[model samples]
Target: MWGGSGSGVDYDVMEVYHLPTGAWDQKPTTGTPPPGTWVYSSVAIGKDIYYFGGRGAGDSGYQYQNSLHCLNVDSFKWRELSPSSDYDPMKKGFCGIISVHFDGEHYLVIIGGLGSSSTPKQPNAQYNNSFGDLRCNEIHYYRISSDQWISPVVTGDRPPPINDFTLTPVTNNTAVMFGGETDNGVSNKLYMISFTETSVDILEVPNPGGSVQWPEGRWSHSSVLITTCSGPHLLVVGGDYAYDVWLLDINKRKWKELINLPNNVTRRYWHSLSVWSVTPTTNWIIEFGGLTEYTDTAVIELRYTSDIDWSTSVIPLDQYQDQLRRWILSDWENLGLSKEVQLLRGHLQDRKREFFEEQLQREIKEKEQIQQDRDKEQQQLLQEKATLSQQLDDATTLLEQAEKDKSSLELEYNEKLNAKVAEILEEKTQVEEKKQIITEDYEKLKLKVAHMEEQYLKEKHIIIDDNQNLKSDISEKDKVIAKLTSQVEEQSQNEKQIITDLKEKDLHIAKLVKERQERVLKQPIKETSSIGLQFNYLEEQLQTKNSKQDTPFSRFLILIYLLFISFVLSTNYNSKQFIGKI
Candidate 1:
């Protein structure tokens, strides 16, 4: 229904069939578009029809095109989509690329296709040879919002390498992939793939029971999904040069053969089928051109539904008037015209007439001016020509002498030129010899550089190993230093406890001496003297014990301080060395 060729030539114009008038209307298009092509992929989403990847106009063989184009169905205008940065322009073009829309019609999933390494002159030649290598298994999707192609990571079982398959949407997120022809042979296996924003899931469906007969392996078939009173089912029409119709109940996953197709129906492949939902419960499939049992043609629906009950049509006379009004408004905006266009046009006409009159008058004046100038120039030229003639006579005499001198000069120049050429040749040879020597030296230098690079890599690895060993040693040392620091802190705490105990003992002793003095004052004089001597002796003993404890503690402090200083100095020295190496 979109684009096809006839009689070994492709058409560029778009035409629509008017059911009311029962005639074809060749719609005018805007913007440049490629020539007509078959086996290209086209999908309708809203008011835009997206076209991608088709063969060029060649009857025997064709060149592939890897371009994306879109047509506004409402405006009947064609515009090429700029290839996104993610798309490779140099990739070979292909046909029979399967695509499906998901994510609320924001993405188009492009699946397997047939491509070649180089453009061949004949399609038969491509299939006969190099078909295996030409098949594509990569999956890419076009994001409508951002207008970019994304190659998604697909998981689960992958479909076989095949092209020219039918992909019919079963639900919002899923599509039923039917038979496709491959290099191996035609495929009868059915598979389903679920699409998401980031990935795709593919699973092959097992055939139903033996009671239900299945369609044979085929490709280039047409399948359309239509909803009936019971449920939605898939209708698969002729494929691989056979006129057979099959109905598939998607929910039951079973196939039922459709009966009573017209007897004169011509089997076709590589054709297109489109559905027209006329009412809430009725739909019709419109089939288009492909290779029939005989040849290819720009054919429309060969078979028609006789009893298509169309209670109302989507297109009407009022709709056409609305479209006309919109088109007029759009054309006015595009041409930068306004209500003042008519007024401006009239003003231009007046200005043009005035300009012609002015031009005529100016030309008349110019003619008079030219005549006077010509007369003046003729008189001057006559006078100058007479003077030039006399000069010519004088120059003729010298000219003879000049000619004689020219011959002698030319001979001398030739000799000089030959000598110069010889000198140049000798210089060229010497320079070439010098260049050879320099090249030899450069080669030697290159070898030396390579050797040096190898040596440097070995040295670098050695240095890395040494650095790792140093780090391990440093780690171990750090652990030891932490243990020693903790021990020092514990010892300092023990010393503080000892000093506190000593102070308490001194307070107790002083209290006991005071009590003895009070008791002696109350007793006899002899008793007082004895008590005093005992107290003095006890004081001296206590002082000796204090000095003994202080001496040992002070020496221990000095030793600990020296050890701490040595540990800090060693740690600093090692840290500096490590940092320098790094």
Candidate 2:
């Protein structure tokens, strides 16, 4: 039996009543630490109920607890173990404490939880914030034989500091942890930690799309692992002051949401959840009292049965009704001493039927309203369709006109390009004729120079042979020399004339290049102007067609508007006429 006081206490107490003969007996307190000591971790070893690590008698808000106490179930006697100074260095709250018999000896294991200190602040002097202080991820072990604490060196990427995560022993050395809140302010991720003699390996379960997103990150949720016919499965229920329940397949490492409890059920968190295999084929998971969001006075019991395939089993609505029917039938068969109760039940059932009918009518009315809304949407769609059809026709006409303009512009551009090509050919012919004339003049100058050199050589030989008349010969030689000098002067003049001609030709070529550049620059602008004119002309024609089409469309719209108004008026008139006839 469980009862709570109206005082705002952090912990609520529960009395375990053993009713073998249908009589109640109050069990004595195990350790009288104080009133309101919130029990966190408990395990039954033999006849003694061992409790570990719970907050007591202060509003420090669920701080780190170190007390270890045991209650003998047979005699109801309490024994308190001395607190140890040697812990895992990190003080933690909501740590996973479990009792496992390894090699015929009992050992208590503690895992990750909220640490004692806040996170360290960053180095910026102006922004030393306190939000970083949080939890630590560490594992510690306590040996029952030596009554001593042993810190085992477990290796792996330690999980982020989090609390309220479930740690269920899947096997002797394996434990699976699922959804919990982290201190770094992130969603909870599913993690599994396996232990060997040398190290611990933490593996993350990958969520390939679908509804496998971890149960919305929450804390203080209860989880229990049980061996079913299909194998071991983890069942989690009522988390972070909520009413949601979920199941996790340990072998598959996937979570499946469970059906929500009925309205009569209460939401709870940080509750005592335990699984008991009632039969080989059936398991009963029970939830005891916990603090609800509204008040701590609330007490609720939720029992879920686990079959072979608990993940796929869905409780049918008909099954709920059938169970109610069975209960009613059983009560009626046992109502021989109370006949009036059966009549009351019949009256209640009739009232329930009437309420259900009223609810059904309300649902029908809502559906009819939804249908009317859909009809209004259909009418709007029809109007939009007519408008779109008109726009499509206008667009098609514009496209045709644009095509015609484009073809005409292309024809004009080709004609202009052909004319320009002809002009370029005429200029090229003129340049070629000038080059031929210059080459002929150079050949004639070469022939004249060669003839003058031959004549000078002959005069020099004649003067060399006449030795008798030396002065006369000298005069003749001077004459020959003068003739040769004049010839050389003429040849130099011809060569200078040829050089000047070549320079003039180079100038002419440069002028032609400049003119060609100017023409090339102007051609693109001229083509663009012609194309622009064509585009403008097409646009005007398209506008005219669009305007003509718009007149008909506007008339159609006006007709539709007038028809709608007439329909509305007629509908109202008919409605009034019918009312009058009635």
Candidate 3:
């Protein structure tokens, strides 16, 4: 067991299971080890094992590796092989690859895997951003000798894009593929791939024919080509979550169930399987680490040990010295067979004939049963054909009668159709006339609406202009009123000035009268009359001026008071009457 992952860890290390010692030892790798070897394909060619694409460790920050690395078993060294052509199969995981030889050159033929949209995809498959994550069905091969990557013009019935499948090579040019995940889901269908000098082909294979149960369709399963004296059988071990085992007799194309390890082996997927042949007859089909239901330490001696996580073991288990290994050795019981049939034979060359004879009888019986089924199918088909022929004959007669009826109907239809056409034409003419009249009416309405809108606009403008003119007239009347009020205020101020002058004049007249009287007393009584006359003239002049100033000023004051009746009284008033009231 080399590189695979399950439970919780990806096994980038190697472990050696010694048949003689019946123990497992963690084989310390010397050179550059794979960064992330999760679900990668590592095929042994000669002494070197070539590891190819698979998922990287999420915690370690690795990406799906597209680089090819080789680990030499003898040197325990790793060397990375760089391909010349940098093309499709962009960093991918869960890919299937097998080493094949063509014309003396060793090549690695690869198939489907899961990748992102950045990776190259088969042009035939439809993809959308909704499921930008893609799976590959394109044929990619690396020429090992030349260190070159090549994509051959693939022809034939190619399988749909898939991931996590097994490709157990059956021949130099052909490899049998079992279950994998496709767009449709996990599949159990089988396919055969044929590799040539310049191209690859795929052909879908029918599942093994038998009354016995077939293995459940699953992905990330393990399958190995277990060759026997009877024939070559594909030993398919635990897959996904099932611990059920099955064998496919390649020659017979039949499936046979092995004893299930539901109680013993932890059901797993993403695991590894290898065969340890101790002798020509003694063999061990060793299964290694994978996903299981529990944090199971490797089972041994039927002891339940959970002290360590053995999921990382290539052949999973955990025990002393951090040794991750759990070797489940059940010899013939594991094989679900006896020592003779299990190939753990002891000088029993005679049993080979017995096994072969038993196989021969089974084959003969299967063939006879298949032949009977074929005969039955043929009989059904013949019966169906005869029934179909009778139906066709009846249909032909009905068709002939229908054709006669069709001719008569066509003739009658033509007469009716002509009359209908004439009536339609007359109706069409009437409709046209009506349409024309309606169109004319519509035009008239449109014009009338436009004219009404125009008149409304004109009236609106006229009203606005007249309202503005009225406002202007009101402004002019207000200006006139202000001018008149200003004039009345000036007149009132003039009246106040004239009244002040009259008071001063009266004081001066009184002073003159007093002086004249003093002079008369000094000059005797004879000049008294003359002085009095003068004083009287002075009084009359003063009286006449006072009368002119006092003519109806009170009435004018009343008019001013009436005009200011609605206004608040101002403090500037000097009139005696107004002041006294205040």
Candidate 4:
């Protein structure tokens, strides 16, 4: 259920009742939602539920809206749709809305409603009660695909200007409308409404044959269309000051009263009924809240079955876990650690995986440090090798210089020169061996460094992927936890309307009692004829004034005074004395 007024809830709340779990969960919404409304016309087409024209308390005060809003159940987001053209639908509440498909295009058709127009073109709308309205025969439609409002040709005797009626669609081209409050009062009659490509026909269904008992006139009653083994049947429930269940067979055009209900479905009005299960053998329908007798009476169901060996149990889509999660995502915030010890065992394995990841990250850092140290050692070894080569070049140049001066000092130091050259040649061989060993060590260090770098890069990539996965897990959990964190967009209905309605009911009851007493006293007078006539005339004047201006206990003093005067005149059998006292 979407937006409604109730005790404690003020704003529009998207509440989901899980049948399997038997829990009511409020789904948080996004975007601007329509103000909390009652008597609004809403029709679900595919996944989107469209809410149109309802009376609500806005920033500007109590207003009857002509605004259109859409809610996508999947996303729990609301969108206020702006009319494409300057001309929009009428500002109304208690209107009838149904989706009609023509040429594969969907349109929202709004029938008769009770409200006023900005221009008030119609001097009097429907029974002259709802003045400044031009909406009796007016049929407004919205092109769902194009976001545009268009007018269609409407025909037939549209059910006399009505509101708060129940419209149940039985076929693609038709629907059945039940009781509604009209300028003529509550209607118990049914109107078979048919739709064409560009026009609608609303004609009354002839009274059921055989003088069967008719469902009493009512408005704001609940009805749903269900298919039984025999065919489709329309079952209607309680209405204002009513507690009766009535059923209609479509093919036969007959009415059947379902009496002796297992549970007492007390008198209620403005309630709602939705078909819970539809099968050839049996059908179950669920009834919801409305103005009831008292707090104790609530939540009734109507079940009708054929039971001809054709029965199957079907699970609703909401019973599935994944989709239900989306509907109740707000439930994750409050978690009770009722089984702390038991839950710790379940998370032990996960903690081990977390430890392994940490160890891998540390190993990668150590490998990186080793790589830096190896690079420095390799550079030092290369510098030492260059120094060794330079020393060998100096030794070779000294030997060549000695060869050039050999003739001059041939015999003088022959033994000494030979010994020194042999020593220098041995030294060169040792230096070459050292250089070869140094080159081999540098090659080993280079291969080790390359291996460490490759391992580090591979480990680093794995950590990056792990980090991304963790981020994703956090994000998904955040969405689940964000359900009721904020409801700044939520708004509620004002209490003034409820107060006014209650006062109206109280005042009507008072009027009924007053008129009943008057009828009893308005009889032919015997001896006190003149006083009785004067009393009746005075009473009529009071009634006229009260009708024009109904005030709370405004006539208390007047009623007491009138009663005293009537008593005096009735007691005094002599007319002359009564006139003198007056």
Task: Point to the candidate with the largest lDDT.
Answer: 4
Q: Give the best candidate by TM-score.
A: 4
lDDT of 1 by residue, 412-512 (tens): 99999999999999999999999999999999999999999999999999999999999999999999999999999999999899899757865765586
lDDT of each: 0.64, 0.59, 0.66, 0.68
Model 4 lDDT at residue 140: 72
List model 2 lDDT by residue over 22-105, tens digit each.
Answer: 123455443453222553456677886666654443366545455566667777666666351234334335667666556777
| Candidate 2 ranges beyond 4 A from true positions | 1-14, 17-25, 30-36, 58-63, 84-89, 118-134, 196-199, 211-214, 263-266, 293-582
Q: How much does candidate 2 score in TM-score? A: 0.45
Per-residue CA lDDT of model 3 for 1-582, tens digit only, reads 556544543254566675433466666576666654676677888998888876666555655767688888877778878531235556667778898889888999888777656555555543332155567676778898788878787777788778888999988777888898887878888777788878887787665556655777888888887654455567777677456667776766667666624433437777677765432223355555677654343322211112211111122333321221112223334446555443444333354467568769978999999999999999999999999999999999999999999999999999999999999999999999999999999999999999999999999999999999999999999999999999999999998996886577546645764675566567753553464465457556645655665657644643443344212222222346343543
Candidate achieving higher lDDT, 3 or 4: 4
Tens digits of per-residue lDDT for model 4, 393-428: 998998888887786578658878889999999999
Ranking by TM-score: 4, 3, 1, 2
**Sort order, lDDT high to low:** 4, 3, 1, 2
lDDT of 2 at 487: 100
> Model 2 residue 316 lDDT?
34
| Full-model lDDT, candidate 4 | 0.68
Cα RMSDs of all predictions? Answer: 28.1, 49.1, 25.3, 51.8
Name the 10 consecutive residues with the lowest summed lDDT in model 4: 326-335
Give stretches of model 3 more than 4 Å off: 1-13, 57-62, 83-86, 122-132, 207-213, 279-282, 294-582
Supply candidate 2's per-residue lDDT for 353: 88
- Model 2 clash number: 4
The number of clashing residue pairs in model 3 is 3
lDDT of 2 at 30: 39
Q: Which pairs, if any, clash in model 1? A: none
